[model samples]
Target chain A: MDGMVLVITSGKGGVGKTTTVANIGAALAALGRRVVLVDADIGLRNLDVVMGLENRIVYDIVNVMENKDLPVRKALIKDKRVESLFLLPAAQTRDKDAIKPEQMKELCEELRQEFDYVLIDCPAGIEQGFRNAVAGADLALIVTTPEVSAVRDADRIIGLVEAEGLRGPRLILNRLRPDMVKRREMMDIEDVLDILHIDLLGVVPDDEAIIISTNKGEPIAFDNNSKAGQAYRNIARRLEGEEVPFQSFDNPSFFQRLRQLVGMDK
Target chain B: MALLDFLSRVLNRDEGSKETAKQRLQLVLVQDRASVNPHLLEELKEDLIGVISRYLEIDLSAMEINLESGGGDTVALVANIPVRQVRRSQQK
Candidate 1:
């Protein structure tokens, strides 16, 4: 197809796959690329809710796949805020096995014709849903946390994705607490990199703004002051073939905080 | 000196949670990649002893079989069996 297909997956749940999809999709759309997010996690669909388009999803992906007469455009929900962004919400009432891998691949191939990026938000676990998500994609992004269990699951998922013949499923380390890492209470980036041994895509710090954004059904990538938003923006830039330096997770200096307090910094 | 060192260790508590996690992950990943359980490693060690005893009088008490992470994305099966004595015919 003309556009690239990227599957965002984490073998373990709650590692920020949906959040990453929402933010990265918004960031890319802001960069003037036509981006369509396909929520492959059928039974547990939340991409629409995360993007505040839950009310706009009239026709879900399962309806499109189950009915041959149904056009793909009918299920496509265009973002009211972003000009080039769209989302194909998953079927919450149906089970994950309701859609097959082949069907998902055909849908993605069809999407790739009209968009510059077709990002599939994969479901948790190495089950049918995971298979369906990766079937259509030529590229993969494995989301993981610094915790041991998450990293282990991510390693297994990476092996499975590579076995599928997909190329360069880069790593996105999520929910990294810089203060805990400095105090040696949590795993540092260096230690995680040593074990995973994959190219670093981007590191998102644990920010409270993320939860607030999710609650409001808005992506933090739109907030210019949010650190996590800045990280997602950088990741979008990198995906556009730009060499962006990794953001330092260092805690804000006292001077910087003082500057902010005095309304001298934005 | 021993008492002072003990006091310092208790007071400093330098090693953090991340170090413990790293150690645990390294160990678990090695075992996972090698697909060898603790019981299997012991059984393999016993079988090696049975085969090697025909030529050498080895110290079974000092034998160790460990699954360690090696260089270049590989897991190495490390076997350390102490040889106490050698048979005459097998000597080179």
Candidate 2:
């Protein structure tokens, strides 16, 4: 049976596309699904580093797409921690034009036959790299932040994804701060959903553990206490067709909450 | 009085950064969804003035052309042209 080709893309850079791919790939593998994370951001590849598989890369995706004799398995680097998780690194020396859309589709087809999920790390912008990353995908996960610019870029990307004949992309709003939202200092999930008008895949709260994990070259999904990690796992479960209620990022003070519950406080 | 005013300001806060974000996003997203660039709109407005002025006495400066989002997936190009009077040759 062929697996799903889910391309994780954000039109703007630094909106956590690579981070989402790494965390979700790890989460899915932990759920016992064989997953392959493909970094389609050719020259500026970072998915391998995020997954801590940078040193293990013997062959890149460019080599696999170019060489007819080379088997695709040779480039698949199994994650050190997760048994079922693997990564297909991108070529740093080559440019985005090195691999055509058709070649990327063919590569995904071969990968789908072996893995349960083919998660592609799409590059920023609506160019050749974006086209190549999106060509083979059955589902598109548009990642964005609560910031105005990121949301605008995500809106543009949603139009392009639908125009490509792919299904309507689900949104993953990353780097949210519930405290800021409560204080009316930041855009909340509802405000974002109102504009994007797509089904919500997940909402990831801004957590410092994410940065720590990234620095350590490990996916935050393994840390149970990390709110962002829990969000990624929830996204993975949602992808697996599970209906999970969104976790409350509300600040809970025992005394105030108790008073509210007893109808003594507003 | 100053302390109470400060407390009220802190407690009764309504408009915040999120409100600003929402307003900005709504305006920008409408333009983005309509695929209407401001520069392109300006050029279109100029060309439209030249074309319409040749046939009628119109207020070119007062004309308004806007790309509006008419809800789900519809972009409406609404143009308001104020015609002062029709040209005598065109009236025939």
Candidate 3:
């Protein structure tokens, strides 16, 4: 089966790139598609911890790249929770320059043959790390928050990504506070889309459950009660070529009232 | 005073921080995406001053040239050249 290599990236740090990668990888794996999460942030690796597979990482991407004797499969750590999910963690000691872009491309080419989805967790900034992360990818998912700085960086990254020949990168707007949006204090999804001018894959509402899940080394995608989890699930389904309606976060109460009026709330 | 402040804020909902953020992002992204080099802009300004100086006597110090967003994917080169006097010479 032909597989897809998708890079999860944000030009600015702390914009949920890693979180989005972990959750989306897990969600896709839960869909029974074999998925491998590659942490491309060499020195500042976080996808391993985020995936809760830090202890299982005996060999990382650097090990596979530097040691000609090491096989790529040996470095891959299978997820404890999801049967089809795997992770190739980045080396904490090595810097971004440790692996070249060509090597990343070769690695992705090999992984795509085995896994149904190869999700690369890209580092922040448009540096060597970012280039290496995107080198082998067939598609890109730009993650951004509603904040001005994040949006600005995302715009720059979008240009850079398109320049790299990866056209039409989908967007995932994360950490959106719908209450603040309702109060006209936060940038809504439309405002962000107007600036970024990309097809939005999904929007994840700011949920406290995300923090709890992250701290516990678990993805919120498994938490059915969390709205953010539901959002990730919808994104995964969208990736799988399914049409899922976006959840209305701005005024759920209005929808609820309408449902009640139509006697559809039973 | 607090009540009046709240009432004023409520009345002027368009002046919310979200609008400010959106406007600021739109303005900034236009400049960021334009990627116009400072050296190029300076050269352009000098060339503009040389060309326009023949047509009109302009104040060089007060002049400002900037790239502004003309809404959605279009950028405008805005030049604010204060004209001190117009040269009405028949000579080429």
State fnat for each of the candidate structures. 0.77, 0.97, 0.93
lDDT of 1 by residue, A129-226 (tens): 99999999999999999999999888888888987999978999999999888767799878988998888889999999999999999999999999
Q: Quick one: best DockQ, which candidate? A: 2
List the candidate 3 regions with Cα displacement exceeding 4 Å. A258-266, B1-6, B11-14, B36-76, B79-92
DockQ of each: 0.62, 0.70, 0.69
Tell me the lDDT of model 3 at A181: 88
Which candidate's TM-score is highest? Answer: 3
In model 3, what is the error at residue A142, expressed in angstroms? 0.4
lDDT of 2 by residue, B6-85 (tens): 58758886577788888878876767755634677888888988888778999877889989766654556799999999
lDDT by residue for model 2 (A141-257), tens: 999999999999998998888888888799999999987887678998999999899999999999999999999999999999888999999999999999999988887799979
What's the TM for model 2?
Answer: 0.83
| Clashing residue pairs found in predicted model 1 | none
lDDT of predicted model 2: 0.91
Error of 2 at A136 (Å): 0.5
Better of 1 and 2 by DockQ: 2
